[model samples]
Target: MVGATEEARLNQLETQVDNGGGEAWEYLCLVRKLKARRSEKVLRHGIFILNSHIARSKLGGEEWTLYEQVAVAAMDCHRNDIANDCIEALSKKFPGSIRVGRLKGMLLEAKGAWPDAEKIYAQLLVDNPLDQIILKRKVAIAKAQGNLAAAVEYLNNYLETFMADHDAWRELAELYISIQMYKQAAFCYEELILSQPTIPLYHLAYADVLYTMGGLENLQAAKKYYASTINLTGGKNTRALYGICLSSVAINQLTKGRNKDEKDSADLQPLAAEALLKDYKERAPEKLALVTAMLRNIKLVS
Candidate 1:
């Protein structure tokens, strides 16, 4: 009892399969579209189509690819029988395929068999340590098992080879933060800022780390970076707005009794922060006002 829209989609795919006119990926495309929709009911439509196609001889070597996709979808739907069928067929056809091994690892992960999943990913890495997908899976398994230390080690090794992966850098930074290692987290954010200077998130994260470390020098640095984030995002960033405000207050406190030269040097920053906060409040007065209310507990004066 598929809906009209999905029934039409299935009919279209069926025409493609029957006429042998769609691209090689027609079935795989259907499986992925259903997966993306994330509806188990709609996903069963995909399983039916795959089974219909599987019973025919019209599909060729590409059918193995179809099996892999269906297997993944089957796992998502918790249809272990269908998934096992696809896996067994794929394993028999390509007994030594690393891609198939990955699918098997994914199946184990789906079943909450973390150690088995990790073992499979580790063996895949041993065969090809540079495989980004396998490396990420290994890291993910480590993190899922609450083994942050092992996850950090794997991520560091991954970045040693793939330094340009901003997501990996961000993940490693978060892991460091969870362990109360602000210095290490700051290093990760620095790497992210170096690679993606225009992104406000990296700037905000780095500013947060520096603000947490809290010294005259770190506060000044944090103030400058928070300002950068505010400017980069055109004042839509509330976190940057709050960051600049707090850093300004903290820096003023730290520099209160310094010499005239040092005071003069530090005075420019609070002015800059005040100006940014002014613009932010102008654009989002209610939000800034609310944030200010929340900040009252800290005894921040205005």
Candidate 2:
């Protein structure tokens, strides 16, 4: 296999593999055929043939080149275990090569080997503490595992150095809601909506928190939020609660007249309840729709 005849025959095949040809795969198939026949001489000579060809190519000049080819060949053949093994061997040979670890970790994670991916990513972080990819992956794992507290903490740490991010704000706010921390969630969404004022769902969330406050004034705010939700949804989601949000605002505005400074403190509990259940229902939804439509019309006209 090491003789002049084998070398001369593989001379052209080696050139093909070195040039990133489909022939590289074909050449490997030939090697496998020889191996299955227990021809170690052919296998050894074939590797040397390929290596000599690679010697003239850019990637082959490096020690990692053949290992890369091995990994690629294994992966191309759908031999994931073989590919992963090759990756491990290459990583050991190239000790601390982030690139190898990254590819292997991704493959393991896709295979549902969470612990393996975690281990690889953790090592990458130690070596490159501020690695953005690692940081994002860490946060994603935390979120996927339903560890919202950890997700929040991780995001907060990240945002300390990277602030005013709209997506992060919304994600944390939704997480807060998932835990039923409506007040905190509302505040977070309020900030996001205030900055990106065109998003109505955030306004709807803010209004929901106000409804939970149980006052006519808060009800007015809640009505505005519901109106915004309707405008945004085009009357889709929150349609069921739309009436409630609108009525709360009507009762609040009627009793307290948007006066955040004043509460309807009188024991007019019977009157408030009657107005809320009976009177507010009679007109608020229609009025809110009319008001919202008019606002839209005005915006369009202007």
Candidate 3:
């Protein structure tokens, strides 16, 4: 389900439990809430229901599943004692299960044991070469160890197998940006824009990359993307508006006294700059000076 529907379902479950519901109702409700997202509601109510129904009352039916979920939720909430207890129970039940082994790796990861976590993930990959979850965890482990190049290599291999994953593409783009690889970052954003045209952030990111690349053709493409971002978000994006101003100035500088379209395209820079200046002055006063400096640099206003 979508975010709104999931939140609504969680809210409904919260309402049901607050009305003095039964054990089964409370257990299902809290588990569903915890599985959806890590919130204070999950940390508090998950512990409560697990202690009462699962521990004290000795609830059955998918007990192992509950143990795994509660272990993860507890770890996320910093309740290591509860998490350890759940892990102990799960290990006893499924001694040789790779799923349980992955949880063990997660527990090591939570404890800052990077080498141990990577070892576990690597062994898991050896057993099942096509396991996407294990490969992704290996990439995460590399990133957590501050090995960006290794993370990038592993992520590239992972994406080769899972080409349609947008989240992986976004993560790859961020990694490229971290290394100052603007061309690679732009390629990632291009893929994102191709897959999700309506997502304004991808258009803005692509525009920012092109603007940073800084050539006549790149600046023109940047200007077009910035315009698309402004249109997509109904001009609510201040950065894209400023991007239009900056990219137009760069393009006009490159093709001075040659292209009439440069003049026509740059006509909106003054209006966009003025409107953005007013917005920054009112909403983000600290940014007003930067806007003023940019407008003066572009000769859009005195």
| CA-lDDT, candidates in order | 0.76, 0.60, 0.81
Encode model 1's per-residue lDDT on 79-142: one tens digit a residue. Answer: 7777788898889989989999998898898788998888888888887879998889888888
* Number of clashes found in candidate 2: 3
* Model 1 C-alpha RMSD to native: 7.4
Using lDDT as the measure, name the better of candidate 1 and candidate 2: 1
lDDT of 2 by residue, 54-82 (tens): 53264444435555555555544455775
Where does candidate 3 have its weakest 10-residue lDDT segment?
22-31
Model 2 scores what on Cα lDDT? 0.60
How many residue pairs clash in model 3?
0
Q: How close is candidate 1 to the true structure, as a TM-score?
A: 0.71
lDDT tens per residue, model 3, 245-288: 88877887888848776766766777778778888888999978
Q: Which stretches of candidate 1 lie over 4 Å from their true place?
A: 1-45, 54-67, 73-82, 257-289, 292-302
Give candidate 1's whole-model lDDT. Answer: 0.76
TM-scores of all predicted structures: 0.71, 0.46, 0.82
User: Which pairs clash in the backbone of model 1?
Assistant: none
Best by TM-score: 3
Candidate 3 wrong stretches, greater than 4 Å: 5-40, 54-64, 274-297
For model 3, the local distance difference test gives: 0.81
